[model samples]
Target: MKRLLFLLKKEFRQIIRNPFMLRAIIGVPLLQMLILVPAVTFEIKRLDLAVADNDRSPDSRELISKLTGSLFFRSAAAPLNMADAEAMLFSGDADMVLVIPDDFSEGLAGITTPRLQVLVDAVNATQAMLGWSYLTSIVRDYNREVIMARGAATSAIPGISTSPRYWYNPTLNYKYFMLPGILVILIIAIGLMLAGLNLVKELETGTLEQINVTPVRRWELIVSKVIPFFIFGLLDLALGLGVGWIAFNIPFEGSLLLFFGCSAIFLLAVLGLALFLSTLASNRQQYLFVAFFFTMVFILMSGIFTPTESMPGWAQQFNWVNPVAYLMRINRMVMLKGAGFHDIARDVGMLTVLAIAFITLAIRAYRKRA
Candidate 1:
């Protein structure tokens, strides 16, 4: 116990003495929370729209007013012809082109059904789809208005009106969804990269050999190495949570103790995996490359930016072994949904098992002679 304490002190001292580590421990989480929470989002807004209005009638003008009034669109150009509208799209000045026929008002007056043409730049598939959907919804609303103005009976239109209640997030703010996932990422970055690099640094400096020859047990040494990073990980979690609450007005619906406890378990598993990987790597560069590769896989598969359900069946099955995926789910459940321990028991159990398995592997992999 005394040796473990001493080694922990030494590790803390090493981190504190290094200026870069100090800045990284304190600054990286702050910057990521401020920058990434707003930047990494799927919510599309303010799409550039080009209009080709062949009819200068009141009805056509009313339709244009409705489209321009929407928050989703900004009128980028008013082209006289389809050729000019197409040119705007080609030059990337417009996201979509709306072509209103000369007979649009006539069709509305019961002569013929009006056909509206929408040409969207499909280079960015998501933006194009979302923009097109927004335009379609606006046109549908305009059509309904025209029918009402023509004295159509309300009973003639049969449709289901859905008032969707977004339970956890009422406003559907993207930051509320992203902050918890970003917190998970910050914890992973600190625990995995720093712990792995610390071990490799010891190897590079010949300190690992010195420690190996000492009276310290391998488990004690490993525990000591992990303890410092475990504390740092929890600190980062707290820092990120505070930032989320203050900067983004994010809610914390669950117990802080419960959230912190789960985060600690996650950090242990990450740190153990790092140490185990470091043992397989003889140099810092090798460990960094290996760590980066695994980090990308873990993050991309973790359902941080996208839903795991959208992934293929085989990839979803692979998430069962992914600690990041488990933790990411736990984070949203607890922080957003106010889920209790019982709600997160299965995931917590899996993480606990992973932590134990990884720590044991790390201890066994560490050669005392080396």
Candidate 2:
């Protein structure tokens, strides 16, 4: 135990002595919090819209008014024809286009269900989805209001209506949904880097041979290495959560202790994996390359930007092994959904299993050289 403390002190001094690595370990998390919190969002208001109104009638004008009245639409881009609209769309000048046929007003006056064409560029699929949904909703509301005013439901019939209660994202703001997930990423990156460097630094400096001959038990050495990086990971999570509150005004709707506890365990797994890779690789360069490769795979599967349910069957099955994915879902539930532990119990269980497995693998890899 005394030997292990000496080794832990050595690791601490190494990290403190390296200026560039120290800056990276601290700076990256802050920089990401400042820049990316805004960039990662699903709320898309003030979108550029275009109207090609051939109807040019009162009813048509009213429909256009409805579109313009929406808070989401920024302004209408002018286009003369379908070709012009197409050009505007491709040039990124317009996000949504509404083309009202010339007979739209006449058809509406005749109680005809006018076929209003809505054109959306799905390349930026998130905005396209929001625009389409908003358009459909506004049009539907207008139709209902018109029907009620005209006493269209004269029969002894009832109308069935529906309302949506968005659970996690009540405001539907993207950053509120993304900040917690982004924190998970930062912790994973930092944990991996720190873990990967620990043994390689000792090996590179020829200090590891001395430690190998010491009286320290194998488990003590491993725990000493992991404990420091695990704390580093927790620091990142704390900084990120703080920045989200101060900078972006993202709310915390669940127990902070519970969330941090889960995050710490997840980072334990990531740090262990990094140590495992460090054991496999003889040098820092190899560890960096290997760690970088797995980082990409883990983030891609983490469901930060995409839904895990949408992934291919094999890929989704594969992410069952990803700790980041577990954290992403659990953090979002805590932040956005205000979900209790019951909502994320399964995720918590999976993360615990992954942590145990990674720690076991890392210890096994360490002993193989014995």
Separately for all candidates shown, the number of backbone clashes (residues 3 or more apart, or on different chains) is: 0, 2
Task: For candidate 2, write residues 317-349 as lDDT tens digits.
Answer: 888899999999999888876778888999999
Off by over 4 Å in 1: none
TM match of model 1 to true structure: 0.95
Model 1 alpha-carbon miss at residue 66, Å: 1.2
> Which 10-residue window in model 1 sums to the lowest lDDT?
150-159
Query: lDDT scores for all predictions?
Result: 0.92, 0.83
- Candidate 2 residue spans exceeding 4 A from truth: 111-113, 124-127, 144-159, 201-221, 335-346, 367-370
The residue pairs found clashing in candidate 2 are 42-174, 168-337
lDDT of 1: 0.92
